[model samples]
Target: MPTLPLYRDDFYLSTAEAYVSAVHDDGAIELDQTCFYAASGGQPGDTGFLERADGSRIMLGETRHGADKSIILHHPLELFHSDMLKNPTADQSAPVVGEKLVLHVDWPRRYRLMRMHTACHLLSVVCPFPITGAAVGEEESRVDFDMSETIDKDAVTAELMRLVNENHPISVTWITDAELAANPGIVKSKNVRPPMGLGRVSLVCIGENSAVDSQPCGGTHVSETQEVGAIHIAKIEKKGKENRRFRIRFGVPE
Candidate 1:
């Protein structure tokens, strides 16, 4: 069954009720619906625990997509050793195929990620260069730009904080794949195109009427720029002849 991703509609949704649709041999559990954000687009998958009706907890190490993007698998932490999900032991017990479960997302960690992801977007706005790569993390995030211009990290940090203090409202607007194809300029990533073939794409816009920035992204973000809070461009490193990597951290520069 295709799992309905509840987070796509509500990033703040941390808990939801779902039923196990399939239990993989590797001990990954698939649900009919989930609030857990599956690992994708540089954002790590959600880690939390599932509660059975009797209140026993099944600790999830990660939520990720199966070979089919629609099939989301929640892996038990016990299956993971050194961040890799190992094959299940022969004696390990698994969730019943049709059992009910209540999902819970680790909110403090997820909120940090959400804030960091939004900060990455703000970094793109400040740099205004084509993004080559990026990753959102709990303590920091890095955005690689396809540019050779000499920029000041402290100056950039000031601009980032300016936007953060402005508290620009962030919102998601859906557009058809055809519309996205028609307006490629809205995409800021030089190497990654938004996930397509799903018929529609989500454009995460900042500011009123997208006055600040707008780009297609599948990752989670906070509701407003101020929520991003105290971010700084900690370092700028030259990756190659033209690639510049900016490291963003959640605190004022010392």
Candidate 2:
């Protein structure tokens, strides 16, 4: 069985854990715990590597969830574990049933993703329309919303600029999947939920308006809006029939 990801509890920094499971056939390894964030919650997968006791190392290419939901599929860049199976005998002290390991994630990439993800939330307060869909990424981000013809894109742009000026704080917390299940009303508004059977859920809050905008989420986010100071409405694109998409991005003004 694959290990549960502990890094979701603390996404701002990288973490280390012990060796837990390995797959011989596919040349992959699953640490007892990992700092490598999986690709879920609209936030992209984290990129990094693993180092063994003997100085041998492998690249972590992909971190994704399996069908069973409890197991995580890890794809390594090299055949770091191929030798263990091919050899008739196991090393006297080689990692077998249990061993110690460390998980390291690229901090710069993670920091940027957190900033972008939180900015997307702040955007929600400024953009009057209810969001239909959204995505948070390292380079750019987008949010689509249900629109009325009276909505003015230009006015919304000004509103966003004002929020950036206000610099409201951002925060996060966790709730049992059951707590969310009990309150179906909040879950329906966001249109996203934690993986089924997962024990708990992480929630991201916008400013102090927790009662109004607290949402069930598992993505990384900034400590406060100050970090996401001033975002520009890069573009406003029309999609489908009545839906409109807003493209948002962060940059130093010229």
Candidate 3:
């Protein structure tokens, strides 16, 4: 069953109501709709709790795609009982099929990741190099570029902050798979290509009319560059003959 991915439409949605459509033997629960973001494109899955009718909570370790992008699974981490495998009725607290629950995302951690992910986009804008790889983290993020030329990290940091200070608006627009195929040059990552076959791809546009940058990304991000706030390129490392990794961290450089 395809779960409604509510976060795709609203990045700031932290809570949503959903009903369990399936319960896997391994304790993974599938919902009819979810605000949880599945682990994809270098961003980790959401970790939070599901609220029950009795006010009890089911702590989820991770949210991920099951089978495909359509089947979103939420894994319960805290209340798993080994006996439940032998006897499905053993764990009374386990989410039952057709049960309704409220999903609450860990906002503070998610907000940090949102900020860092947005910073990675700004870094790409400043460097303008073909990205080889990237990872979004709460405290720090790294974007690897297919470049050999030596560049000053401080200068990159300054450029990133300049974009941040400018407070460009960030918004998402959808494009069909065929539309993306026609515009391959818009993609910046050399190794990772945005997932296709989903009918539509999301273009995260920064700045008015995408004056700053626009690219296909599946990860969540802030609404404005200023929300990225004081990001600095902590270091740049030579990974291979042509690859260089730029590390981004929050706060101004000391």
Candidate 4:
């Protein structure tokens, strides 16, 4: 496994190509390089297809984080899978190492993830309490924070709308593994932090506010905050002492 493109720059990539390094049965292929973002950092992987030099586009099913944590696995579309089911030897059609292919992501879906992702940041920065954890989805987002005795949905929603209305710019950068190890607060992990010796970690910065909370993240986001339209705090819950959960949704009446 090697460094992937999605981790470096996520502003949106075009005119890139990579050679197929290996393939799994049923349309999962590994490429030498890719722009498809994997399902890490609590953000879903990118969805799209790969086109061969033969003018054939093998549709991508879903992007998943490989156990290796370095390589991204792309599943072929259902139609492609159906063909494989029709012929058990369909695995033979898998792209071979050294075969050049063009990868394309469903821009509409990718855009939605980006918007929702930026919205998650809004949920964190706009609110008063500090975030302890978060999870983002295509339709919704949730974040856990350490707060006072009770959480106020109306106030939080108002703050998020105000922030989104401001339309802040988002950016990402890569920090070396040594720096990340020196400061364990950079990336968020489960009970234990993932090894940072891999050489570089992705840092997502929202708004140019130096006081805003910054963390190591691998998710996709929008260029500006205004794109997250008409969002509100759809739900809230108490998750134990000092932890309050907030579920954010979009397209709701203002």
Candidate 5:
């Protein structure tokens, strides 16, 4: 069954209540609804835990999509241990289908990613080049642009801070699959397209009325640009004749 991904609608939701709809032989738990963000679009999946009625917790190592994108699977941290993963077995205490559980997201880690992911967006705005690739991380993030022009890292950093300090409001709006197909230019990635099989796509817009940017994305983000505080472009590496990878870090470069 397709799980209702609550994080899609509310990025700040760190906790939620849900019923376990399925528990796989390998120990992946599926919930009727979830606030955990699955791994997608260069952003890492969420890591957290599920709590039972008695308050016992099952630590989740990561959240990911199942055979179909609509099915979100929460993998327990214990499942990642070498022996357990090699011969996977469901713990005796594993929740049964229809059991209720309270989902708790590692807010501090998730908040960092949100801040970093938003910083990546601001980088795209400052660079204004076709994004060839990107990755959202807690300590550092990278946005690869398809351009040969040499640009100063410090200049990019300054521009990024300007947008961050401006504290522009960030908002999400939905567009139907057909609408996205009609206006393909709103997508900035040259190689990747937003998940479209789903009826609607999310557009993460920055600034009032999207004065800064409006692009399709399926990742969690901060509500305001200022929340992406103290970010800077640490380096720009030439990967190819026409490609440059810009590394973003949490604080100003030394």
Candidate 6:
């Protein structure tokens, strides 16, 4: 069944009520609707816990998509150490289908990721180069550009901070799949494209009227530029003859 991705509409929603639609033999639980973000793009999946009727918690290690993008699978933390469901102890039974639960996101970890992901977007705006690769992390993130131009890290950091200080509103808008296909230039990645076939694509817009930047993305980000806070380009490396990797970190450089 296609799980309702609540995060798409509300990134700040950390808790949500959902019914267990299915529970796989491997211990992957599916929900009718979820705020838990499934791993996509360069952002990691959300890790949290689910609360049952009895107030017992089911610690989820990560949220991921199943066979399709719409099918979200929540993997329990216990699945990592051992298969708790394989031999259900009387006290620790697996979550049954149709069970109602409350989802709780690991807010601190998620907030860091949100800040770092937003910083990556700001980096792209400052560089204005085709992104070859990227990764959103808790402490540091990297955005690789498909350019050979030698740029100063300090200069890039200054530009990123400028945008952050400007306090631009970060917002999301949806575009139809056909509309996205019509406007290929909005995509910044050189090799990777935004997830399609789900009917519509999300456009992450910065500034009042997307004056700074607007591109196709499905990753979660902070609501405002100022929320990115104290980010700097820690390093820029030559990955290839035509590729430069910029490392983004939180805080002022020493």
lDDT of 6: 0.91
**Global fold similarity of model 6 (TM-score):** 0.95
Which ten-residue region of model 6 has the weakest summed lDDT? 78-87
Model 3: colliding residue pairs: none
Q: Please, what is the whole-model Cα lDDT of each candidate in the order they appear?
A: 0.89, 0.67, 0.90, 0.71, 0.91, 0.91
Lowest summed lDDT window (length 10), candidate 3: 79-88
For residues 167-194, could you state the per-residue lDDT of candidate 3 as single tens digits? Answer: 9999999999999999999999988888
- Runs in model 2 with CA error above 4 Å? 79-97, 150-154, 188-191, 209-212, 252-254
Q: Each prediction's TM-score against the native? A: 0.93, 0.81, 0.94, 0.83, 0.94, 0.95
State each candidate's clash count: 0, 0, 0, 1, 0, 0
Report the C-alpha lDDT of model 5 over 1-254, residue by residue, as the tens digit.
Answer: 99999999999999999999999999999999999999989999999888877666788987999998899999997522234446567343678999998899999999999999999888888888999999999999999999999999999999999999999999999999999999999899998778777799999999999999999999999999999999888889999999999999998789
TM-score for candidate 3, please give it. 0.94
The C-alpha RMSD in Å for every predicted model, in order, reads 4.4, 5.0, 3.8, 3.7, 4.0, 3.3
For model 2, state the Cα shift of residue 112 in Å: 1.1
Give per-residue lDDT, candidate 6, residue 20. Answer: 96
Q: Write the per-residue lDDT of candidate 6 for residues 1-254, one digit (tens) a residue.
A: 89999999988999999999999989999999999999989899999899878766889987999998989999997522134446455356788988999999999889999999999999998999999999999989999999999999999999999999999999999999999999999899988899888899999999999989899999899999999999888999999999999999999997
All candidates in order of TM-score, best leading = 6, 5, 3, 1, 4, 2
Model 4: per-residue lDDT, tens digit, 109-155? 87777888888877767664666777777778888777755657778
Candidate 5, pairs of clashing residues:
none
- Which pairs of residues clash in candidate 4, taking residues 3 or more apart in a chain or in different chains? 61-75
Q: Candidate 5 lDDT (Cα, whole model)?
A: 0.91
Candidate 6, which segments miss by more than 4 Å at Cα? 79-90
